[model samples]
Target: MATVRRKCFISYHHADQDAVNQFVRDFDQAHNCFIARGLGEEMPGDVINSNNTDYVMAKIRERFLADSTVTIVLLGRCTWARRYVDWEIQSSLRRGQYSTPNGLLGIKLPSYSGSFPERFNQNLSSDFPRIDCYARHMSYPSSTSALVDAIEEAYQRRTTHQNLIVNPRARMSYNRQCQ
Candidate 1:
């Protein structure tokens, strides 16, 4: 049997596209990665520049929603106010697909000045259950390392869940199994 490649969907504001692209490059070099922006390169010129918002959103939904096993939302300074970003997060959560120990991950991109974006504070009161959130300074060399670590951790959790499902008896038979 062929091994299934794990694909991740990246959600970010267009203003942060450069940074997001860099992250995507690093991730693709290290692991199996996919981003809707990159995928747009394959489309016809007119389709790529279409002014129809619904058509564009439908394309994004069809491609990313269907293919990706995980969604990574890159939280930038204005990310909270971006309607599309908010919609993406809400839609992903509503899909009832990705979840903790197996699904979506949220990474907060610290400002260039090595501080959390002010907007993050404003939106701190909002509730998001499916997102596994983390913050790292974009200016630090270890920023990418932190993201890589989170990805690995999420993969491990997913692997453990898969194991449990594949051999439910093993978990049930364990001496430490919950009573």
Candidate 2:
């Protein structure tokens, strides 16, 4: 039987929806992937205001927390300040079931300015791993390959940690007997 490739849960600010959508489309074409944005019912016009931010975030969390192996945070300038983006990143970290070594990976989007957002500066001490997607995009011959490499590396780290946790006996044995 053929093995299924892992599905990635993409988290991003609504303001960066166009870039996120483009990334999703390109990534999907290049690799086996799935994205959670725009996959549900359209938001009511009345429910579109910032006052309903919590409600919108809850919906994003519900959609992303199921059947996804990785959570990729597409970081734009406005991403860090957005409440729902922050909530999603925090929620992904807190989830016991889907926890991975690199439970969260932040991808810095391409922009003219090289500086990170102020919110990110304040929250840099947090556990999420951050990588410059723009740099990676420029480094590789193709953006698709660069993204694939990033995803694979992060997934491998997560799976390796999962293996260690699930097989503590082996870890203990190696430390005591083999070492």
Candidate 3:
């Protein structure tokens, strides 16, 4: 039997490029999934304008994730705090004009220390209750097969978990910086 290659969007903190690079390389070597698109250092803007923001986000949807079937989030130290990552995740979850909800997965980098961004904080209902816990994890580095399985699982979830919608509470904000 042949391994399935999913169209995967690589989401990561700009500060953690090397980790995601290695992940891409490994996935390619194994034919686990295709690196269909990526979210890198390009920020929305220094100033927040709704029109520009909407335009940029639309471009992201059309260019980056419009064809992807899954989004593999490489969770580095500051990934949880980055607004772009939140926006990417939010965008990935929509079943709208851009694209249907892509499968979602979160991986903890070697530097992970259990602190996650509010978006992944499964238990923040009082503040902004998230869908909670679908993020798979491993303490050490992840293997290609592991990620492939995760991608497929997330793909499967889009059908099973109709509850996975954009959480208004976890919305991204440019004014805030990670502490």
Candidate 4:
């Protein structure tokens, strides 16, 4: 049987670049169940200052998140508060014009215990079962098999839900999301 590697879009806060760097390093050392090379850790300086929200999103969808089947959000202190992260989350769920909606999961950063993104918490609230709920999350440095299962599970769950888009923690769009 041939082993398949899922393309994973890593959604994270810039502040947690070190952790993401380590995460990618560890991923490279694994049995190779994922492909995360489309997008780099940092956005180009010109793109950062472009201030073209629509263009940026289109580029992200077509270039980076394209062909990816799952998205893993590296949860940090303020992951939910980031505008780009929010956009990424939303775009990942919607199956954009040029991109498919990737399955979702959250990985709590190593050595850090923090709350999951607010959008993912709506299901827990007594708001009559939110239509858009968050994806299940776990801690980082998890076993390759476990992480693979999570991604596969998310993929299966999406098929069943057939359009489940969870709420995002921050506003959907902005002229400038993060600095």
Greater lDDT among 1 and 4 belongs to 4
Error of 1 at 60 (Å): 2.1
How much RMSD separates candidate 2 from the native structure?
12.7
Quantify all predictions' global Cα lDDT against the true fold.
0.44, 0.47, 0.64, 0.65
lDDT tens digits, residue span 4-92, model 2:
45566666666666676667666664454433333312211222344464565566555555555556777765665555544554444
lDDT of 4 by residue, 31-108 (tens): 676777335453222233356877777777777677777878888776766677777776677644554467788888
Q: What TM-score, computed on C-alpha atoms, does each candidate reach?
A: 0.52, 0.56, 0.76, 0.76
lDDT of 2 at 165: 22
What is candidate 1's TM-score against the reference? 0.52
Give candidate 3 regions above 4 Å deviation. 29-31, 40-51, 97-99, 122-141
In model 1, how large is the Cα lDDT of residue 100? 36
Candidate 3: how large is its RMSD? 5.2
Q: Ten residues in a row with the worst lDDT in model 1?
A: 166-175
Highest lDDT, which number? 4
